[model samples]
Target: MEKRIVTVQYNYDVAIVGSGVAGLFGACHMDPSLKVLVIAKREPDLTNTSLAQGGIAAVLDTVNDNQEDHIRDTMIAGGYENNPDAVRLLVSRGPADVRELMELGAVFDRNPDGSLNYTLEGGHCRPRIVHHKDSTGSEVQRALLAYVRTLPNVTIWEDSLVALLKKDTCFHLDVIQEHTDLIRHVNARVCLLATGGIGRVYEYTTNSKIATGDGIAFAYRLGARIKNLHYIQFHPTGFANKKDRETFLISESVRGEGGYLLNAEKKRFMQNYDPRQELAPRDVVSHFEMVETKRQNSNDLWLDISYKPADFIRQRFP
Candidate 1:
């Protein structure tokens, strides 16, 4: 771990310690004159952003959707526990952020008229999610990565791990190089951690190998306030395959597009509890599934969309 390449030191105006959508996009939007460094603990493609199958939720179309509706829906989905300021900011700025994402070369699914296509999801009052089929996150990440690559002031370091962080006058990070097994100390005016969620702690999760609470741990160590760590959002319909802990997530859009939630007995469980049936917010569905699974003494839950036409599934998810 103490292997050395050189004693040379480097400094940057900003250091982003994750190459996900947030870090890449943040770097893309930074001042071109400022020195920025983006670090990824593994291959750049291993982020949870690249694993997202569902689309982004925002009011991209005012003709059918509005900010108030989006905000209300988001707050309701969060059980009204979301920070008001954060929700306000997200609902207000999310559309522009998405448009900027498009201007940076993101290609989203479109309707026959060539307008951006929108889809419904749990807790959404309108079909406001703009996606690139089922690979929306990967598509957005690809575009941001391309845009950031063209910026001359930004440097990307993949396979670099932020081992520890210390702040005196500026933020100092001890980065471990995976290939060389050497430590590099990076000093920056600001350090941004978009290292993603802690989903890997769960026995079954759709998170990537990198989502091991690293960012939160670092933030807590640095005296940053960590709130809502207990508020984990679980998807109800992860494919319950055998042995593999890294469960594959069937997109939420399936239920949003009218799928059915069934128990081991092949009974529709959600309609009895909510008027929305399978289209409740993910957390609500997860809780319901948990209760039902425990009550039934089984783990065989399923999501079936086979009622839809075969060609439609291929076209919609292809």
Candidate 2:
């Protein structure tokens, strides 16, 4: 097949901001003949997707899992306040989306018999997480980026920040490229924002430094409707040390794979808070840990996976 040509014409069929999962996936789904411009505040690999430790949630093996269970679990975790339509859409499409990732060279961990390995996470009724050891995010990002690079219709502009978006016949973006300090006004027939998360606002977070709420802020400035700004999902285990204070994340899979939350007294305290205990949803576990920390007047807590056989931890986590 002859490769399609991408010209830096006066405009593009679509302009996507933030080359994370959202942007990359959007580009991947568009017509190969359509010109697509992907703008990122930094390199595509530096986005929040690259920092994720957990895997994508999907019911690939329906023999053991179902979308209804996933939806119910998500709603319960969201305090029964999640958008039903959105949750339904996600649950319905998640399996196919994850399958697309696999086709694009995302190497998920597989069982010895060559079937997909699905691990359990908090709020999940069955083992449904598709991951690449502890570096699932990096693996997915790499696979997506690799595929995106081969698409002749796609162009990636790194270190370019979208300063403004204006509605017209098409969307207009006032972009500032960091290295050259050059500013340009570009218009596209369609615009998609895939910028992820707002963790920089907090004093402590497990998010990457680039998760600075820029996308949400930009959307708000453009008069777009925003939802769930107040709800921040804090992971239960972060490598809580002064040196690597906010950078390292102890994957939730550790807890899912038989780790226990221990207080200063070395007691399994999560059971006292929720029946699911360590397997409770992230918000529940985080809030419970906070309550325990306040009660004991101590900031430090421990997540003990020591009970698991050493080789299993090394093989799965290391």
Candidate 3:
């Protein structure tokens, strides 16, 4: 018989499963003295964060937009059923976090005068979205990953799958190293689960492969109370690719920057539905699209922005 004992070499101060935006950002806030390990089930780039294209909605321009307005918009979008305290916290702290990302080399567009250019998204009273072209999520991920790499206290393991988690005095994670099929027992004083969305549950969704809601499932198994699991949201405009089961997202930022949505008749019809027109929030747009598509008896719709200047569209959306 072979005797086996789990070694102490796998210990860490903190263990983060999933390398999405939340995981990476949370790791950035930890003390440099603490030993931290970030585990990605696949390559670090394979995350829902990279698939986000619509950009962060932060009250960056305080003169034109206030925290209260942003909070109100969010509440309205949620039909006033949102947690007021949580919404307030997110609205207050989000801008500073986004600004921190800028300092860490995340870039966004600037006007000719060189001030941060803001765009109006649906449900927003003012232009408050800051983005790096159409690839805002990718830009933020690139910057944060690079900054995390520079931290001496953090270790990143890619292609590492966290199979199971159990709680003792501290948390023990069963991590499987891919390709080699070797298993290691890693212990952490604190554990954070940042696994992204659960879009794979649907056949048509604009979610990445890594978004299987594994974190939520793990937490539920550990007796954590799960709320709002029923409140799943959908993106309005995903690229109509029949060959790809996973639809590519057409960012709402395009509509924010003045893209128009047309019905099968080739006539712009969003204004007839909502006064905000193309600038309506995602839930509103998506819900109405379903209703109207059935009413009109067609699955086809067209989105055109040709009326806007070509130079402007290329520069803003590119």
Whole-model lDDT, candidate 3?
Answer: 0.87
Q: Model 3: which ten-residue window has the lowest total lDDT?
A: 1-10
77-166: candidate 1 lDDT, tens digit per residue: 888999989999999999999899999999999999999999999999889999999889899889998888889999999998898898
Q: What digit string (tens of lDDT, one per residue) describes model 2 on residues 24-117?
A: 9898999998999999888889888888877889988988888999999999989988999999999999999999999998999999999998
RMSD of each: 1.6, 5.5, 2.6
For lDDT, the strongest prediction is 1
Per-candidate clash tally: 0, 0, 1
**Position 23, candidate 3: lDDT:** 89
The TM-score values for the models, in the order shown, are 0.96, 0.94, 0.95
Q: Which digits, one per residue and each the tens of the lDDT, describe model 3 over residues 1-318?
A: 754444234999999998878889988999999999999989997888998887889998888889999999999988898999999999999999989999989998888899988887888988898888888999989999999999999999999888889887999998878776367789899999999889978888899877888888889988999998888889889889988878998888888877888877887778778887887778889878887788789878777888899898888777
Q: After superposition, how far is residue 162 of candidate 3 from its true place, in Å?
A: 1.4
Candidate 2 backbone collisions, by pair: none
Pairs of residues clashing in candidate 1: none
Order of quality (lDDT): 1, 3, 2
Candidate 3: give the clashing pairs.
122-279
> Which model is ahead, 1 or 2, in terms of lDDT?
1
Q: Against the unseen true structure, what C-alpha lDDT does each candidate score?
A: 0.89, 0.87, 0.87
Among these predicted structures, which one has the highest TM-score?
A: 1
Question: What is the Å distance of residue 211 in model 2 from its true position?
Answer: 0.9
